[model samples]
Target: MRLDELPLLTVLIVLPLVGAAVVWALPRAARARARTVAVTVSLLELVVAVAAAGAFDTGDAGTHQLLETHPWIPAIGASYAVGVDGVALLLVLLAVVLTPLVLLAADRHQGGTGDRLQHYLALVLVLEAFMVAVFAARDVFLFYVLFEAMLVPVYFLIGAFGGPLGRWAAVKFLVFSLAGGLIMLVAVIALYLQGPGGPQGFLTDNLTGLDLPVVGERLMFLAFFLAFAIKAPMWPVHTWLPDAAQNATAGTSTLLVGVLDKVGTFGMLTLCLPLFPDASRWAAPVIIALAVVSVLYGALLAIGQQDLMRLIAYTSISHFGFIVLGIFAFTSVGVQGSALYMVNHGLSTGALFLVAGFLVARRGSQRIADFGGLQKVTPVLAGTFLVAGLSALSLPGLSTFVSEFLVLVGTFARSRPAAVVAVVGVVLAALYVLITYQRLFTGPVRDELATTRDLSVREVWVVAPLIALMVVFGFYPAPMIDLVREPSLVTLDQVGVPDVPGGTVVDRAADGGTDDGDDEGSTR
Candidate 1:
């Protein structure tokens, strides 16, 4: 719990900001130099993050570690508090890991390298800083600042380097994000005004500890949930996502869909439940229904997509459905499943986007119909896409399988009908992913793409680890399971849900779970 021990979180957030500054300060002629600097900084940040994870005590994750809290705006009772339980730590690690890979992927494609590359790298680094902050911030206001601020860089990313419709996509994305952010901001203000201790104002930990009135609680909860839903891009609000992804460059699309989008669901699991337990319980069934609908709906849309990147975008909607499903299941298994799925989905889908980007860069087309017999033209590219595709489908021996299975199992314990409907999502995922593979990678070789090469050395290096980790974690998820077990249990308790005994961690009939933070002596 020493400051040095907690330096990981600090460095994870700061390094990216520093990188952004460096990128921005670079000479106009040093585009390549700027890229190099951005990559180096991100890689260093990733290393520090990994080292911190190596030192983390998984068994004692219920309680915060490397805890740092200090007065920021003391007048309003806001503080610069930051720490990580198991779930937060894991996500922090995942965000760090993906960033360098994103930089590498960006470099390999060299898509928008002239005047725009520096800005792109800077924006990405800034986004990374916000991402780490979101995972680490212990104060409600700090989290909200980071949450909403995360969108700015992405807005520039899509608008600057995306497809022919990039400008439109960026504008749409900003409008939706602004609308959600403003609503959430109003809710935050309300919470502060009415919070316990009178004028002491709001802090996440303190807010969760307060006993607000039921009606007030539900409204606050809905405010937060609506914002997260839009970010999660659930069903009705999900249209923006596909357009943004389709318009973005391969690397930007990969990072946007893979990592940034998880912020919505992450906020739900970490902030909403802890701060508004009763409201969450009351809204559980409705949220679960929406989750199932997102699953089926996202999948159907993905199945019918003619655009590869857009298809990947729709798949995220479906994947997020599982995350939402897990959150509402009110079980430790479900919660942990959702958290792990968040990380797993990032790796698998990020790789898929990377591969798709590679294809689009080579073929200069986004349409699936434009791709034909890619396996014949470039076997390595085909194989990489296959691995990413299988992982997306939650195939056995891939990272997503464990999490997706846990979500369904936990959900079934509480809502059999919802779980049954969700199962169809799994089947649909297989169809969409496999059909995409068949149509794009397995058809007759196209004359235009015959000379297209397989993944380059840097490309392989960037994605190889992701694919390997997916398989490694898929078959042996015990380490990850242990990482979030107690934190998730605490989260479930915060949501006023009972824990399931034995294999599962949710009980539908009772609100009984342990979040006493009593196990302080457990080893990593």
Candidate 2:
């Protein structure tokens, strides 16, 4: 079959599930074989993702590509529809790319040997399938189903494999996630009730043309936004993250923060703005305010964290603030930057979590004070930590910098005050990362840390892909930017906003001019 004719997305979604089933069906003594099968299957999924990318029409990034559809519930107007826009494609690839690395990282689970290992690997694959499906779902109902279903494997992964606090963390994660899902369910139902009656009512395209009552639209927007914000884990609702991250395995943390949490922002971009344009606009001020608060608040908390995993978790909260900021800025550059940020954050933060996991495994503790002068013994590991930390801080030569710069520049065009305040988070980020590095990797060597070894060959191979992507995308972001541009423009169009010309504010401020008298065309 031709590439476009193939049910490539369905295969991509189902293959991991099939692999999971196979792994579970293996004989009890085939532990090693299970590991091999899991890795091999994950790699195969990655190859499928690449093929999907290869067949994608980059020039037409706004439209969904390689769509597969079938009616599942004609009575309620729902279907098993799947497709990928540029944003969805990139996130789908992120989920596929991270799963194999996470499996490799978790190869030696601290919990069990034979059956437990197989179970853990199987859960990861199942989670991968759900994540891919969440991004690819063309029908809103399908998206919500996949979105809630993803929590199942993650709950098991954390509760079963995480540390002593695992069970509690898992419960907390479930509570928060389920609460969000329930709220979103209300919104989904209300949307359907208000939508044009047809088999396509649940589809995003059909939902976009909806014209709900003014108050109802705002209420629905809140339902969806609250759900996504909790998933995004913004500010006050973000307490579950540090607990979940600290307790879960590094690999679990990687996928949890890197891939799954992104669905929240992805939902915001795909569903919230387009489906409720007026509500989105009405809600932007409050959302942007909370996003800025999350930036500073999360960074401050990261600086105060003693546990490495919690620290990384807090940094993600901070990074997500930037993402939400860009999305709300309602400018093309801001939206595109936010999209790229989703991908780059996955790579950089995934690396950080995995490296920290290695360190914690060696030191038998997550406390920053437990290790001192680790550079003396494990220079390579320290170097890895440093690079990942630099990426977290959006260092000049890393992938994050390009995306973050665009976010700031784009936000500046729309709101100078918000941009300036958000920039403070950058300084705080540097402080947090540097202080953590100094405490953990610098200072005099501790007796306990002296025996710590460098990264294993497997560990090196696992991290190399993430590190390489950081540097590669850092220097050459054109391909990714190109992929995201059209989607960003589409978002702006949906919101009835136009891109504010770059440097308009800067030029005005430099000339000692104000918005009071300048013509709009002159500013453009």
- Which one is best on lDDT? 2
- Which lDDT values do the candidates have, in the order given? 0.83, 0.90
Q: CA RMSD for every model?
A: 4.1, 3.3
- Where does candidate 2 stray beyond 4 Å? 109-111, 505-524
**Model 2 lDDT per residue over 1-524, tens place:** 88878888999999999999999999876766887899999999999899999999999999999999899898888989999999999999999999999888875544256888899999999999999999999999999999899989999999999999899999999999999899889999999999886887798878895768989999999999889999988988999999999999999999999999999999999999899987887778778889899999999999999899999999999999999999998788889999999999999999999999999989889998888899989998999999999999999889999989999988888778889999999999999999999998898899877888999999998899999999999999999998999999888778665557755543222222234664554312
Candidate 2 shows a clash count of 0
lDDT of 2 at 121: 90
Residue 33 displacement (Å), model 1: 1.8
Which residues of candidate 1, in runs, are more than 4 Å off? 1-6, 107-111, 197-200, 502-524
lDDT of 1: 0.83
